[model samples]
Target: MDENGFWAMIEAAWGVAGGKAKPRQRLSEGKLSEGRAYALQEVLEEEVVPALLERLDALSADELLEFDRILERKLYDIDRADIQERTDGSDDGFLYCRGFIVGMGRAYYEAVRANPDRAITDAECEQMCYLSWHLYHDKFGEMTPSGISRETCSNPAGWPPDSKPDAAPDAAG
Candidate 1:
């Protein structure tokens, strides 16, 4: 698909997976504003993926492999879980799905940052986001706000805690 088509698909998939709305209705009802869509595309292409890659670049090959393994584990969990099995059903599932999408976006960013010459394209990011959303939604029914919060908290250093040690420890001690 062309770039615009690809992004549209990403937005639609996110809407559906996150329980935002069906694409047709969202388009007709003016829910999926063009500006918002464009902004999301920009963030994915220019900012998010680049940032992620930068973070990954600082890691050694073994670290990258470990991060990949973590992502794989999360993906597996998404595939096996059934959203409808939960009491909250699809609504809660969607929230969780959105969280996963955000996480995947961060991952793409890391990957692109790690290898600037091999930066991920907008199309690739969109496709990955779509897939991640569906995987989480299908497994979790409706996603919870708590899930989103937890995802946000996954990187505590991003926010930084209150205190730190003032001096270096003696090696001999």
Candidate 2:
């Protein structure tokens, strides 16, 4: 799917699951306390994911692949040490946390992408990491692999070459 189409579905899912209040607002306004964030995470998994999957279910195989690519790229792009540290997860957990950010739709994703401090610690949307996989399997009874890896520290630009995920960025004057 194209970017607009992809984000429209994400927005729809968030609206359905989280009401009219945008996640970016909640995060920026400090409305999502730990308890509220956890509650939102549960709603995302139980409600938003299914809503998104239902929308994705209508796409052709090629569209599904495109969706997978976009989602992978979004997750990969945010796999930065600065962002991951704020989110308080590592490895698969960090990957899922990125998924949660993406699931909040384009505005929220951009906000968090531009500011690592916007990340919500302990809030995760794990099901989002497997969205395309589940849909592809349910539709065609097989797995569909994409060109990118959504794992933490997978993006070269986000991490120093040959450095561990938690390593600090280079110092320069």
Candidate 3:
């Protein structure tokens, strides 16, 4: 799927998992506690995940890979120290936090991307990161790595080469 289609699925999932009052409203009002985060995750897992799986099930193998790549890019693009610090998690936890941001849909994702301070510290959506992998394994009996790492600080462009202590200096100097 294309970027728009990818985001549309996310948006739809968010709508389903939102329940009556809407999760974003709670997010905006700063009501996201650890308990609330877990509650939201539960709803997403129960309702949205099966829906997402059904949608992914219909895609051709190529489209599924494309969707995974787009998800990797989205997660990669948000892999900044500023965002991670705000979210406050372990390496894997940070990855899930980023997935939570993407699962919130395009508007919230863009908001957090533009301003890391907008991140919610308590929320996570780990399942969103591995949907394509799960489907690919089920369908083909094999899973190819996406070549991009979804872990925090893994994107060179987002993290910057100079920011890494082990980075090599310019050879021409």
Candidate 4:
């Protein structure tokens, strides 16, 4: 796939793996609200990781390495502590969780690629993906019930929060 297509696939895969929300309920007198934490936990543990590993097995050694590099870049690009802080705020928590998946994705991809003679299957991939996702959830906790609010969050900020137009170099004499 082309670079754009590849990243798109990654984004789409993440979306599918992220799953959908359930119906919301009203907060009544003295009743506490519960989120979909349990369901999300189960899905992550049961599905996503395995799918990823299966995909990895289908690739050639070189292709697997390429996938590993992509995942590694993603992991390195993320700010771990910031992700943890945002876990309470938005889908940044899911983005953080993606980091762990990326790590396992890379490792398993490399492992299968390095040993091409070994057989790997879709079921195994799904298991790995599920395991990775669950591990992330367990370590990080459920993503905020509000889920990730991508609408307000910037993937990359335009400038440092403290910076202003005054910081720019003068263009006019």
Best by TM-score: 2
* TM-score of candidate 1 on Cα atoms, chains taken together: 0.30
Candidate 2 lDDT by residue in tens digits, 1-173: 78898888887877777564664568645566767667767878888899988888988888887888888888989988788878854577788889888876776688888888777886888889879867877787765556568877767688765444443333231
- Per-model TM-score versus the true fold: 0.30, 0.84, 0.78, 0.37
Q: Write down the TM-score for model 4.
A: 0.37
Best-fitting candidate, measured by lDDT?
2
| Predictions in order: lDDT | 0.34, 0.77, 0.73, 0.34
Q: Which stretches of candidate 4 lie over 4 Å from their true place?
A: 1-34, 88-173
- Compute the lDDT of residue 135 as modeled in candidate 4: 40
For candidate 3, write residues 68-128 as lDDT tens digits.
8899889989987678778855777788888888876676688788878778885788888
